[model samples]
Target: MNNNPFCLPVFTDKWIKHFNTSGQEKRFDFIENVSFVKKSFLPVYINVGKNLTKGISYKFSNTGKDFKKKVFLLYDVPDYFELDTTHNFSSLKTIDIQQYPGYLVGTSQYPDITAFKKSRFGKSSLAKVNKYKRKLESSFDITYTLYYGDISRETYDLVFDKFKELLEKRFSEIHVHNNNLDPDEWEFYYDVIYDMILQKKASIYVIYDGDKPIAGSINYHFDKVAIGAIMAYDIDYSKFYLGFTIIHKLLEWAIDNGLEIFDFSKGKFGYKTQWSDQEYYFSYHILYDSSSLLANLLSSIMSLYFRLKVNLRERNIGMLKNKLLFFFKKKKKRATKDYKISEFDDTIDSQKFSKVSFDVKTLEYLKRITYDFLYSRSEHIRDIEIFQDLNDKKTFVILGKSAKQKVTFE
Candidate 1:
């Protein structure tokens, strides 16, 4: 009923059937109507006729014997798009159809409540969640002790060294195949993270097992949401599920501090889904020069093959009982020598941990005293010092140098 001439349906099943029904089939051509310009690496345009329901036409070159003598018919349309900014498509050859890439898309608009509810520790429904909450009347011992402090220079160095050691031990166990993340890269990344945390738009939570920090997570806060940016755990404690426990502790801290949402960030993995209730589609777009026709054709073919392979893998993952479809095989390698525990004793200068030289034993005693005092008076230390600017905001707790006095969110 619309009067717009551009609003015509050009490629329809009825028109195709009518074309095939005609006695003359060799070198047949038909015009298809389209409103938008065809986007392709090559320059192309669409022709729309006056008859709104009818088709429009386009031309193609017949260059060599290598080209098909006849047009091949297929059930599915080829996945090819013209090079317009809007990404419109029209006709594609059978060869072009085989070379499309498969991709994933992620967006923030998707609701993840259902996925969250299905997580390993998630309650099935609102009623069940309320029931569970009601049953727990007392607080339990959380695995990690969260602290915010202006760590001394020595302490910073010690922490960074420990992190490097932990990364070396844990990377292989975690099946991290990226050979690019070497010690130097990690050190550089850590330095950047540490600076950001000190600037107060971020906070680093170190999880200690006794006097040793075995796990840690860096969090960035924005309004009511906290994003767990980077996390690492000592490989020696892998059996204890230290990573999960650390995350659990972080979430508990968020809830206690009145934070509403925890963003896990991007990556498609079963563990992420365990704590997340949503998924988003992510896509990739590639632009290539039309002058390199052979290269483009070959690349397109390879892309299509990979797409099919990835699709099959995804389908298999969906059918499996455990969504994390990975296999690990143990291989013996030369174990790195472990440092003696006494080397970390408090008898050494605590300042040596950074570069200054204060008695390590004195440092240890001071920490214990600070911990005891903070533990007892944490409730009184309610107001947290938060810094914010147009670009970023962060929440933090400040612990005094010589006193047990601390500052934190109420």
Candidate 2:
């Protein structure tokens, strides 16, 4: 009976960081346990033992080892947003569809921000500050609906196919080359995701536009709280503002269903900030066996260096781009001179507005930032508060004071 606790597999360094930051720790003795995988390898799975309530155990696997980690770590954070129990949509009179033409504009048009402010529900009454702004448009006849269900074999296959298709199209558009997964591996990945979603009581919402699937989102419900997961929209209907419409519909559903928190997940994007009034701090952890000290130390040192470089580039380069855009706009305005200044200014403003008004470039930039920085960083281990002592063959558990208690172990 080899009594050595197996080192659980981790999918990414990000997951390792998440485990470290989650504030729970345990040591498993490896008496009857043996692991075929090494912690240093990519896609390391660490088995902690059996879960009592859910009858499900825990394992960690890293999907990417070399990719640069996104800065906005949503998966590392605790849920800080409280569910609003008083939200009611039926109380407000529904506006005629013919009155609001800009309702279904693309996400790049800042529809999410606009809708958040304009929405009659989910507004905080504590302060009189207005968050949403009004947009000029006629009414749209479309109404976004929310749909949720378990991932069956058919649905799972559909989602997996859609994800691959979307990933390939996006990669090609960006001119990036990456290896595609074989059918078996792809199915395995989907199975893992599907299992996790079920354990988390997750639901998928697909918003339709006249029977066509325009946008989709995955949401997880824990207790009375719902966390928004991966969301994407069809590129062809980018001008339809499907993302915002879907979000609004989901929020309404949350309120109606008595779900408390609607976590936007992790990121500090302009739109997320505009709608969300709260934020939770998050951190990352790095752990390794004491026997493998040298290897772990080297990996940690390299990871720290890479992270520092990334932070510097994001701050400095991002600032430089903003400054350059500001100067260009200033110069453009300064170069404009005419005898009829008011009339010329009006004409210029009209022309400039018309040229840029329907431009979804800004929306695309927001999506890119959110997807790269916020959404990508959210893939990590969850429900990892316990560990099995491999040395003693007994389950070592860590207890906390409160339901949302924060605990850390080395």
Candidate that would win on TM-score: 2
| Most accurate candidate by lDDT | 1
Worst 10-residue stretch by lDDT in candidate 2? 94-103
**Backbone clashes per model, in order?**
29, 43
Quality of model 1 by C-alpha lDDT: 0.38
Q: For candidate 2, lDDT tens digit of each residue in 249-276?
A: 6766665566655767543555465455
Model 2 global lDDT (CA atoms, 0 to 1): 0.36
Local accuracy of candidate 1 as per-residue lDDT tens digits, 1-410: 12111122222222222322332222222212222222234322212211112112222332222221222222111122121232222223323223212111121222343333334353454344433222211111223544343555576676667766666556554444322144444544455445444544456677665566767876654445555655767654333455655655565566556665565643455556655544433222222333446535644654576468557656664334221221232322323322111111122222322221112532222322223333333411122111112221111122322232321211
lDDT of each: 0.38, 0.36
Every model's TM-score: 0.39, 0.42
Candidate 1: how large is its RMSD?
A: 19.2
